[model samples]
Target: MRLRTGDGGETIDRQDIDVNQVRIGLDLSVPARLGGLELTPSGTVHVRRDGGAGQTGDGIEVAVGLRAVLGTARLDAQARTLAHHRAEKATASAAWR
Candidate 1:
C-alpha cells in the first residue's frame, strides 16, 4: 500500500510517520521613507523537525525570506519562506491600508 502526507510527500509501508516539531521564528523589518519612496528590508528564520516512528528519520526545514514594501505594494524579490511551512502557501498579497 501507499500513503501520502500533508507535506505533498509520499510514504511507503505506511511509514508510521510521527512528526514533532518546535519552531522559533522572527521577522524584523525597518520601514522608513527615503526621499519619496517607502522601503522596508525584511527577513525571517525558521527551524523544525519531522520524524517518523522508530526514529527512522527526521525531515527538517530551515528557511529564510526577504522582502520589500514599496508604497501600497509588496514584492518578494527573493525566496519567500517566511511564516510556518505548512501544507500550503500564499503567493501574493496586498496592503489594504
Candidate 2:
C-alpha cells in the first residue's frame, strides 16, 4: 500500500490498481586481456489491468548484453526486443589523469 498527496495536500489512494510482473536474469563473468567482461541476459513478462473497465496490456521482452572494462575505458552494449517494440543501445567512455 502507498499514499500520495496533491498540491493542496490531499491524500490519494492507489489500491484500485492490479498489476503483475515477472523478471528473470542471468549473469556471467569472463576474464579479459586488460580487465574483464560481464555478460548479462534477461527476460521480463508483465501485465496491467484497470478495475474500472477492461483496459489492459501485456508484454514480453528479451535482452542480451555485455559490459567490458579495459583500463580506463568502459564499453557497454545491449540488444532488446519486445513483442511489439524493439530497441538497441551502446555506450563507451574513457578517462585520463
Candidate 3:
C-alpha cells in the first residue's frame, strides 16, 4: 500500500480495496501545523491448488500501515486457514520526527 498528501489545505482523497487474488489501498490528508497524518491499509489474499482434486487448499491474509511527519507508525495483521485449521498474527511499530 502507498499513500501521499499535498499541502492543498483540504482533506478530500481516499481509497480502499479487497479482492480474491490481490488487494491494495491508499489514503491522503492535508498538511496541518499542529500535526499532519496519513494512513494506508492494504493486503493480499491468494489461493493455490495442485493437480489432484483433494490437493486443493485456500487461505487469507491482510496488513495495515500509517505515516506522518510528527509521528509515523505501521500495524500489520494476518489470518490464514487451511484444511479446517486457522492461524493469525499481528505486529506494530512507531517512529518520532
Candidate 4:
C-alpha cells in the first residue's frame, strides 16, 4: 500500500484558463513468483479537487497494472481511466525491458 499528496496547475486550451488542484492517490500491489517468473499486480485510485479560473468540479482516476520478470527480461502493462467533470479519457500501455 502507498499514499501520496500533491498540488499542481494546468492551462486549458488556448484560452489561458488556469486550473489548480490538490491531488491524493492510493496504490496497492501484490507480488509473487510463478515457476521461473516473478509477477506483480497493482492498482491505484486518485482524486483531486479542481479550483481556479478553469475549475470544473472534481476529478478521479483509476488504474490497474501487471509486471512480470524472468531473468534479465521484464514486461509491464497498464490501463487507466480518468474523469473530470464533463471530460473523460482512457489509456493503455505496455512495455518490455
The global C-alpha lDDT for each of the candidates, from Candidate 1 onward, is 0.49, 0.44, 0.34, 0.74
TM-score of 1: 0.42
Candidate 2 residue spans exceeding 4 A from truth:
1-15, 34-60, 83-97
Off by over 4 Å in 4: 1-17, 83-97
Model 3: lDDT to the true structure: 0.34
Better of 2 and 4 by lDDT: 4
Q: Please write out the lDDT profile of model 3 over residues 1-97, one tens digit for every residue.
A: 3444574354335643333332233333333344354343333333332222232223333223333333555343433332221213422222222
- Model 1 Cα shift for residue 81 (angstroms): 8.7
Q: Weakest 10 consecutive residues, lDDT, candidate 1? A: 88-97
Q: What is the lDDT of candidate 4?
A: 0.74
Off by over 4 Å in 1: 1-15, 54-66, 70-72, 80-97
Tens digits of lDDT, candidate 2, 2-88: 455564454456545554544444444454453254333333343222123333333344445566665567777776555332212
Instruction: Report RMSD (Å) for each prediction in the order shown.
Output: 11.8, 11.2, 19.6, 12.4
* Least well predicted 10-residue stretch by lDDT in candidate 2: 85-94
Clashes of each: 0, 0, 0, 0
Task: At residue 73, give the lDDT of candidate 4.
Answer: 99
| Top TM-score prediction, candidate number | 4
**How would you encode candidate 1's per-residue C-alpha lDDT over 2-92 as one tens digit per residue?**
5567777554864555656555556666777767566666655545443345332222233334455556777765444333333222232
Rate residue 76 of model 1 by lDDT: 64
lDDT string, candidate 4, 29-89, tens digits: 9999999999999999888666777534566777899999999999999988764333234
